[model samples]
Target: MRILFSGTPAYGHLLPLLPLERAARKAGHTTAFLTHASLGDLVAPAPVLPAGASLEETLDEFHRTTGTNAAEDMSPATAGEFFGGIRVDLGADAALAAAHDFGPDLVVAETADFLGPLAAAHLGVPWASHGVGIALEAPLAEAMWATAAARATARGLALARPFASVDPWPDCLQRDDWKPSRDRITVRPEAHESESGSGSGAGWEAPAFPGREHLPRVLVTLGTIVDDPEALTEIVTSLAGREVNVVVALPPSSADGALPVAGAGVHVTGFVPMRLLLQGMDAVVCSGGAGTVLSVLGAGLPLVIWPLGLDKPLNAERTAALGAAEVVGGAGEAGEAVVRVLEEPSYRAAARKAAADIGAMPRAEDVLPLLTARLG
Candidate 1:
């Protein structure tokens, strides 16, 4: 099978796909990834859209659809950026020019890959929603979009547009059990039983960080796009000189010099091989972005979340309530929150259960089989 895949820059969005991507390769199917240029360099090289296109185009469209450019639009923009960006990103994700530019038997992506579904629908080919984040129930996601419409209409801006018409989740996966809907992952064989990709393979080294072997490690990330260094700063200070070891992967800042200043007790890096990082860490204190949360869960570690910016708060709500982790409001008390979560055994217990929940998911590598059967 030939696959054209589009994913976002957020580590949460991209990394969960690695194991699955490798799995497909092991199965001997050709796969190509569409993402940021820098990241494309890190992974197997694939076409990259303009690096800033995601935020730029998304913001432009949000303003256009809502008819708000100045301050009137700022509030909703802060809260609903991801929810609204999908419409603007649709064309690219679906590979409009990209679709014909690179024809594939299938297009695989998360719901955020706005254009993937449309392009697949347009091509009369199969497009599977390879979610790395939470499962967006087709109906519930629609309702959330509709809620955005109400906000737009209240301001007398533009009218609400139809974003999704079908159920986003496949019929078989939908369940009302109220657990964190982690990635319905499928790892390709190259990634499943193999550590080659995690080390040096194909001229790329698997993501890993040094000097963290002996500490009771904690991973704190705010993802690449929606960064909050102030929160990291606060976290380090809170744990200042504590016995526990804390390591943060600050992307976008991409600079070890940009590491969060802790009280000589915390260590930070611009990037860490996340899969390897998660395997070694005891827990994560994050903004609850999807890829990181899913990875941690996939590894069965507890989570202490301080959701900031975009879908994080919403994502936090699901996992925290389900005993997978704990949630702090934001950067304000990030450090204290981390301390509290760690002090309590309940957090660890819940995290264990959450990990088991993730193990139950179908591996992300099996996309072809699932799609073939579903659309057969």
Candidate 2:
């Protein structure tokens, strides 16, 4: 079967879909990824059909759709508009073109990628949805459907939900209100740690810090899109002066001298493979992005989350409610929070339980049969 995959330009959406894409390819099915033009290089070796939206354009569309300029103010209303805008402005025309040119047997879209469903509706073909974290609520889903309805009408098609929905969130971690109407196949969360190509690396030397192996190690990340370099610098500086060994992973464009105090205890770098870093770390401090939170939980590492905006605050709240993490209001509190997570054994135990729950979930390969069956 020829499969076409679609997602937003961000790594948070694209990375979760890779394990299944690889599984399809290994099973001798041809696959291609359709996303924003900015992420085209990241999908190399696998044929990339550009959606013709740049990262800035996508961000602008998001703000326009959501009716908010600040990421911190994201709400259900914004989510609905975001999905609607994505389908109408970002990926619809490009997806339609890919459907005609690629001739895919099925369309597998990232849950956030509305264009996949629109194009599938246009072509009268079967399509599937993959969820990175939690499922959408009724209001958000309805808002997306509203946009999709208009698109379908314009294309002379009927809007319909996906034939299958792939979710990576474990049952325990899922939102209480999220119950799927479609066939919900749960997959384990796997972290993709590289900037380009198939990110399968697990082997990496721990960041060089002298005699620091004895001290507890804390990993800090703000993700790629969040641009709070000052906050990141403060967090790293606050921790480096403490008893713990600190590793700060910054974005590619982060300034070389971002951190104020650099010593043997703190190591700063641009994009270390997550699987490799998690192997040696004792605790994590992050911006509460679902991808990072899940990765930390999957590794059984207690985390301290600084919720900046968007879905992050909710992710932080849920994880903290589950006892796996402590959410802080700002970066200043992150240093002390990390200390608490390290000293408290209960947090570690909770993390282990979450990891066990994730372990009990299905792998990406387990979904291939269901996907193929749906195609038939």
Cand. 1 TM to true fold: 0.71
lDDT for 6 (candidate 2): 85
Off by over 4 Å in 2: 61-67, 70-72, 177-182, 193-204, 253-258
- Candidate with best TM-score: 2
Query: For all candidates, what are the clash counts?
Result: 20, 0
lDDT of 2 by residue, 309-350 (tens): 777877888899889899998888888888888999999999
**Tens digits of per-residue lDDT for model 1, 43-88:** 5533454322544455566667666542123243433444434443
Badly placed stretches (over 4 Å) of model 1 are: 8-11, 35-39, 42-52, 60-94, 137-140, 143-215, 254-256, 260-264, 330-332
- In order, candidate lDDTs are 0.55, 0.77
Question: What alpha-carbon RMSD in Å does predicted model 1 have with respect to the real structure?
Answer: 7.1
lDDT of 1 at 375: 46
